[model samples]
Target: MKTKLNVGCGTDIKPDYINLDVADLPGVDVAHDLTKFPWPFADNSFDTIELINVLEHLPDTIATLEELHRIARPDAKVMVRVPYWNSPDMLADPTHLRSFSERTLNFFDPAFPECKDRPYYSTARFNIMRKSCYIRFFYYLKINARFLTTPLFFLARYLGAVVWVIEFDLRAAKSDNK
Candidate 1:
């Protein structure tokens, strides 16, 4: 059985996974605010963790991601989805403390220049397996087609307010020490 953790699950509760949220909603298995440090789960506790539409609301991006790394088991899958920085979706939510671009997550990868030159920023390491962005057209039609991430579409997104949501699928790189 897959031991999955739905962090900041909010109203999207899952039956089989461990659902967690800030409020004690109907099916929320844990009601702890994610902003606090040292989550109740043990280190290396989960096989898969989902942070869909969650990271933007947190104040400390690096610290919060590091905490996720601490709990994730070796090669565990970490799914992150956040509103694209240039989109109105990011500004619409006042609770969203930060915005994210496709390059935002690369800072945590050791091989990436963002991390390689500044290793002291964090110990967290994750290999990005895949990344994609969705474009929202007139707040109604959403273009989540794979072609949106292609070079042409990707460049187009950067030139305008196209990509609304960005997602990253990561594989945690851990050692016995961490």
Candidate 2:
């Protein structure tokens, strides 16, 4: 059976997923602190995992990503959503420890320039598959969200605050160690 994990799934539980959160909510299947290292699951335990609007709340982004990578099966797909770096929504919540942009996840991509030299930065490797952006004021208008992250990703470099949230689909790289 394929195992799927919904990390930081507060109250939104999916019957198909093992819901996890720090709070002992009714839907949480595993109420464990996310900040702590070595999640309860064994290595390469999950084939699919998601962190919807959860990355920003964690204190250590890289560490959490690494742990997620450790528990994921080879080439497992991981989805993450976080408040856009320039958006006020990131600062609106006191629990938000950090904000992210279209390029923020690139730090975990071993092929990305930022991580090429810093081998010690993070051991986790992910190949970014797709990225999308959400604009709050224009929520009703579905103005080509893909462009915000494609060749026109440069737009965020200048007018990033306009973006409310950024979502990424990543495929975990195969690891020999695992």
Candidates' C-alpha lDDT? 0.85, 0.84
Best candidate, TM-score: 1
Compute the lDDT for candidate 2. Answer: 0.84
- Give lDDT for model 1: 0.85
Q: Compute the lDDT of residue 39 as modeled in candidate 2.
A: 88
RMSD of 2: 2.1
Model 1 spans with C-alpha error above 4 angstroms:
150-158
Where model 2 places Cα greater than 4 Å from the true spot, the runs are: 138-144, 151-153
Alpha-carbon error at 132 in model 1, in Å? 0.4
In candidate 2, what are the lDDT values of residues 1-178, reduced to their tens digit? 5499999999999999999999999978999999998889999989899999999999899999999999998989899988888776787888898888777888888778877867688888899888888765555553437665554456656765567778899998977568
RMSD of 1: 1.8
